[model samples]
Target chain A: MQPEIQPAPSPASLAREDDVLEAAVRWRAEGKAVALATVLETWGSAPRPVGSHLVIDDTGNFLGSVSGGCVEGAVVTEAMDVIDSGKPRTLEFGVADEAAWRVGLSCGGAIRVYVERID
Target chain B: MDLALLTALNTERAARRAAVVVTHLASGVQRLVRGEDITSDPLAGDIEAAVRAGRSGVAGEGEARVFLNVHVPPARMVVVGAVHISQALAPMARATGYDVTIVDPRTAFATAERFPDTPVIAEWPDKALPGLALDPFTAMVALTHDPKIDEPALEAALKAGCFYVGALGSRRTHAKRMERLAALGLPQAQLARIHAPIGLDIGAANPPEIAVAILGQVIGALRKPAPAREAAA
Candidate 1:
């Protein structure tokens, strides 16, 4: 005998990072400026794994995630700057950042995010 | 940030081909490497190895710093039974990142109330399997004790080149099944692909434990190299 069955949650987010990449490509092809940010590395109890991504367009629209909201705002901010300057930059966030403290990741983890404009 | 490279990735994904996107961080140069087209890329060996393992990560340092974003089609599982084992296996398979579909013609067994997480197709395997598009990333399991239900699914799995195929049966049952399949013109090589006992012999006495064993075996067959898997089998 089996218990009452509940509908399983959709696993649509499994390829979310790839979706962001595809979206970035499409946005660029449409002549909209776009920047791609990836979690190149992480340490301690980081919320997201390495290779997590956040793709941002010029209008501030974004997709995917480099962190569990702990560092997306900062990454988005850096992403916009990268899109404007056409220069790639690396960002670091941990409990050390007061902003990170305000959001979360109070678990004391650090992450290295790289942002580059997709030309 | 190369549009060409990104476009290539999108194309490969659309074709359901596995690939890896390699990017050099400092210079921000990127290239898309499909598993089959690795020889054309300078980083052929490394990128192919990474994609085969289905893992993405950063390698090297300084100017050589490379990020490999491995991409493979999502894993899928086709279960040919709406029995108790499927009730346990479907959810467990979903938890293990498999897109599961349960196929059982018996409406009483293959109902939404029984397999809430998967698409329950109330059609025989021969009728339902073709639409599922079982591929290298798929694992097929025939859990129905009835040969009418399980054999057709097993045939479809072998023909489709599914990565893992298992059927629930005891040793004597499997011996009889092998005879029947052989008489049906399935080659020895194709018939060998079936893991007749279904799950790993881990002293599994209940449905959930059996499900775990089956999923574990499927994962092993998926993750291990073919030669190594042959040796283990």
Candidate 2:
């Protein structure tokens, strides 16, 4: 006989990763303007691997991390502009850029983040 | 990053299916590729490689450059015997990022006190495994050494195309199993997939060491190139 099957349980880490995108969908459904920032590339000792997501809302609320607590403030600030303009922006963070000096990766790594509004 | 596309991505994730989000950095234009459609995608070559490696990165060059964000369901390990080896393997599998579950009809062996922090189902494999919805992402290990218990679980795992299928037995025991399975109508090709005398040949002499060997074998089956795995099978 064919038995009723249930979906397998997801690992905690995978669930955490999905939580980022799930929150973006949830926030957007709640009428909150949302922006998603994804780590497109990373070099050297990157804290988070590529594909890590950081979701932000118009009110400056956010979930997830694109870096090790560094550069998130800047990414959130940039995400607000993305929400307003509806234009995607790519931000690069590293010790090499002067802007990054203000919000640098303390791990001496470099990363490129793509921030886009969920319209 | 359209809400529709984001929603679609999450839907695929919740269903435990693989998908990729291809985003053009210059134009901010994006598209979602479900696992089944990857072969027909324009960037099929790159997307296939990225999905296989379970990685995300920038592809192409210049204005045509795009980011491929790969999402694959986490691997799962389902042990059919809640015995001594499971006591060691469950925690190790969790640490290595696999969702783990143990099933055995013998309630005494599958007790919560013996497997703290691990999910133990005190039901026969035939009853419990069907509800688990064994899939390609799952690794199945049958360790009870009792044909009545282990055989059915192995059969189910094989039929489900589990990424890894293993059974603990000596060569003689495995040979007898092959005959029994063949008589039950499983094809030779499918039967060849079972890793009898399970685990990597690491000279393990105890339950914990045997668990290490099995976990290593499962990881290798999951990560190694597809062609190589087929050859080994």
Candidate 3:
């Protein structure tokens, strides 16, 4: 169906399918293990939607995106770790909560994701 | 490795299972709120709260219902007709990350070239369907208007328990189609599952627009129910 954007292999962007495929394909071609993280749902003013996906390769290489460049780096790093360990991970991004504040969620919105390795 | 991920995706779409998604926010303009990286404990952190605060999607923008679908085995879309509409739809459908198969008996029309990246089956419906292992997670669409092709494929789809079974046609065409389906011994109640005039009434005319409408309806039906307390399991 009339793609949301024009053809000719558009540049990568968060919340784009090509971005994910691009990263995954690149990683596969380069002989790296890759893992995929998909956004299942978003609440408040989040950047992406439920079906948004992000992929990362074992060498820390990555493609596609799940947020407004707010958390791709961290997500990619996490994906690499998940692939290395062979464990599925569910990550979260959201508002301020007491205790520990390691990951900064700038949007004040919440996003849930499921991460699994893809070789 | 890829197959495992696809399987998970299929499970969620087929069973409509609910699960939370976690995102790690980055530093930027406006707000910069930090939260505990509580995903370490596997079952740690308040999933509902985290998802809500993150604004996983545009909050409550459009009337689009959001559900945390756990793709148990991954989802697949079986397109019974390798027509132009399928060409437009296959990639888009893949975007939402559904495995796609284009089925058509026309050798010339159902070639890998027509559907560049999809699995194109140049065999008849009966021959093609039996091999696909149709499951509840499967979604079948008959884009070809030929009764010879669509009828048997649809019968197989109904028996396989596909979540969404749609056919490309107009309201008038659907009425006539019902007659054929009835003659084939498919009950009216069973026939109701078929989205005869498939796709939302977007008033689309072209192939791409029509494909969009069809995919939209398919997405809506396949997505898990909204957070209506009553519907929650």
Each prediction's DockQ against the real complex: 0.38, 0.56, 0.15
- The sequence of per-residue lDDT tens digits that candidate 2 reaches over residues B66-173 is 999999998999998998999999999999999999999998899999999888999999899988889888999999999999999989999998989999999999
**lDDT tens readout by residue for model 2, A18-57:** 4999899889889999999999999888899999999999
Cα lDDT tens digits, model 1, A14-69, are 33435877788768868899998988788899888887778899989898898888
Worst 10 residues of 3 chain B by lDDT: B27-36
Highest TM-score against the true fold, candidate: 2
Per-residue lDDT of A46 in model 2? 85
lDDT per residue (tens digit) for residues B108-132 in model 3: 8898888999999899988988878
lDDT of 2: 0.91
Q: Which stretches of candidate 2 lie over 4 Å from their true place?
A: A1-18
Checking candidate 2 for backbone clashes, the offending pairs are none
| Clashes (N, CA, C under 3 Å) per candidate | 0, 0, 38
> What is the per-residue lDDT of model 1 for residues B137-172, given as tens digits with 9 covering 90 to 100?
889999989999998888888888899999999989
**lDDT of each residue in A14-119, candidate 3, tens digit only:** 2244445445655666787878787756778878777577777777766666777767777877887788897777677777543113465677777777677764
TM-scores, all candidates, are 0.86, 0.91, 0.51
Q: For every candidate structure, what is the RMSD over all alpha carbons to the true structure, in angstroms?
A: 7.8, 4.6, 13.2
